[model samples]
Target: MNTAGEHMISEIVGYISELVPIHVDKTKTELSSIMTKYHVTKVENEDVHPDLTEKIQLFLSSKRLEGLAERTLDGYAMELRIFADHVKKKADNITSADIRVFLGNFPNLKMSTVGKKLFALKSFFGWLAGEELIKRDPTAKLKPPKTEKRLPKALTIEELELLRESCKTVRERAFIEVFYATGCRLSEIQKLNVSDINFQSMSCKVIGKGNKEREVYLSFKALFHLKKYLQSRNDDCEALFVTQRKPYRRLTGRGIQREVKNISRNCGLEDKVHVHVLRHTFATLTLNQGADIVAIQEILGHSDPSTTQRYARITEERKREQHKKYLVL
Candidate 1:
């Protein structure tokens, strides 16, 4: 493989990174054709002057600083395409006014959905601004909807106990413990191969959004459940979690989500308990247990402390802890 070809294809990070090396053995002419077809040109610096669509594609394609699961990348791609078409059709410099107008025009969108679309715009514009393609970051003054800052919906101590009682089945326990303990995303958990778990260290390696990788620690309880789940597994499958549905197979992210809801319902919890909420529960529970916010960021594979701090902000334990210290020491 030529230099650029080898560099571009083989450098993927994630569970895939741990696998066989990339098949970048394209002929020099083939590589040249690809570079030409894409109109990819290297700037003086380590940058490319790709078009709006290609730029976003490149931004997504290039390695992520904080790894993420592939499904997340797909979602980001979908969101970006939506935003790209929106902005491009209306003409660029797609200001905050444009964003608000576009969203407002689409009255069918819920605020949460609006917020997600806005976030995708923010990421898109931020990248454009980085390349000096845009004069200003239109999303600079943009605000996500002021949805109620309710404490992240979580399984209460008792509800968790109920989940324990109701989640007696093997897969249920595995789902609960793994999410509550490691805080890995549903996609990450679903994509997890048994090889990723280091039982001796009680750590599970996760590939997070953007193809970033991090090691999430498993509690003793979670580790035990994982071991048990593995023991019950057939050697034919390599996935850490699998389904009981006939012709049993590796579970998908949706599978885990459905299981979370089933477990939540059977335990009599009215609220839905998706994998993310369980992950949120893990973060908040760890914080309440006095884990450092920065440490939690690492465990959760968040690139920015501010992102991890969102989980902390939604909770009172951090503030209450601060108040008590002022009273004495």
Candidate 2:
């Protein structure tokens, strides 16, 4: 064999040695057999690129500084990690083709989920280009996979009453009312402090996405239940909601979701409802009852008017359904 062939074989052996848990000598016989069956060519100008993991960390740090919520940061990190693992290439070496293959690898994922992964990649590469970390953004020309626009599913008034009746405790009752009344995100509600509420004003301030603070009003029924729940608790935990047992702690987002799902099951509702469903319900019902789209947008802390317009679209659909069902000549 020529010097170039020997050099390529030695590089392959070294690479395999790094991957195997056992010693290199033990695998050499099997490695030799595989090496003899294939020829290797060394590519020129195979430049070393910056580490993918390090670049991802920098991207996440930049996002954190921009006030993205921890959950959102976590999601971005996960998607990027998946990309790094699949491509096994450094940040600068990643190409649009690599991204396309990475996305196509998950054949079972929905288009919506694939779109989200694509979005994360786009954002990361866009940042790298802006910071001069990469000469070009790989995702600049890639289009996200098309996804269907499904209408938001909001509970009917009768279903809402049924869910209210299914509450097994004052805390549950308060949670249902407050969630619907404020239309707060699950994280926003979980982070609420007891001091954030003002009984006299019938409102409370919540820290929302991007750490932005917003005031949301409580309905009379919500206030009545919330005040009752607070009064009923003996523990001095400062959170607006607490676990029902001793050594009381602030209710976590998962805990809140579990409670809501339990209530949903108890009511025999067809839809498996969670906090986000309640948020949609709140927006849909409010829009149906004559609330302005822009007003709901502000209340929901939506930066874009188009996001709020979804609920308006839901209301319009419902109006058409009602007209078809009940309107008579």
CA-lDDT, candidates in order = 0.72, 0.86
Measured against the true structure, the TM-scores of the candidates, in listed sequence, are 0.68, 0.82
lDDT of 2: 0.86
102-192 per-residue lDDT for model 2 (tens digits): 8989899999999999999999999999999988999999998989998777888888899999999999999999999999999999989
- Residue ranges of candidate 1 with Cα displaced over 4 Å: 1-69, 80-98, 129-147, 313-326
Estimate the Cα RMSD of every predicted model relative to the unseen true structure: 14.9, 9.4
Model 2 TM-score relative to the real fold: 0.82
After TM-score superposition, the amount by which residue 227's alpha carbon in candidate 1 deviates from its true location, in angstroms, is 2.1
Best by lDDT: 2
**Poorest stretch of ten by lDDT in candidate 2:** 41-50
Across 217-326, the per-residue lDDT of candidate 1 in tens digits comes to: 88899888878878887666777887886677788778778888888888677475677888888887777767899999988888888777767643476677778888
